[model samples]
Target: MNVDLDTAKEGLAVLQQYGGQAAAAAGSLLAGLASPFQLFEGGWGLNLLFFGVLGLLAYSLVVLAPRQ
Candidate 1:
């Protein structure tokens, strides 16, 4: 059995569509992971304290550390 050029082109187009969908799904997953605040929103006080500590740590790293 032999395949022609049109069949090969259609196969390539299908592969490209799947690749694009996979990329979109990956982006959505990363967006969900990257937000610390939105993940713990139900407990307001705890969320505030958690983010405050994160901010403090970031500030300490950026501001108080000696430049190398």
Candidate 2:
């Protein structure tokens, strides 16, 4: 099937934006995991706990956000 040029470009733009976001998230997670001591200069346990809390916040925001 032949796709319109503008439609194809829009699709590519969306894909690139999503990829960049994913990469940034992965990098942050890796940074937190790779250097627990360096992450806020605390131990791995604390670092993990921080990530857990962060995840919970995001989860709650998604699940509890008012639907449009």
Number of the top candidate by TM-score? 2
lDDT per residue (tens digit) for residues 1-68 in model 2? 99999999999999999999999999999977776345666466777788889899998788767553
Model 1 per-residue lDDT tens digits across residues 38-66: 64755667767888999999998998886
Compute the lDDT of residue 43 as modeled in candidate 2: 61
Q: Name the lDDT value of residue 7 in candidate 1.
A: 95
lDDT of each: 0.84, 0.83
| Clashes by residue pair, model 1 | none
Give the 10-residue window scoring lowest on summed lDDT in candidate 2: 35-44
Question: Which residue segments of model 1 deviate by more than 4 Å?
Answer: 37-68
- Residue 27, candidate 2: C-alpha displacement in angstroms: 0.2
Please state every model's RMSD to the true fold in angstroms: 7.2, 13.4
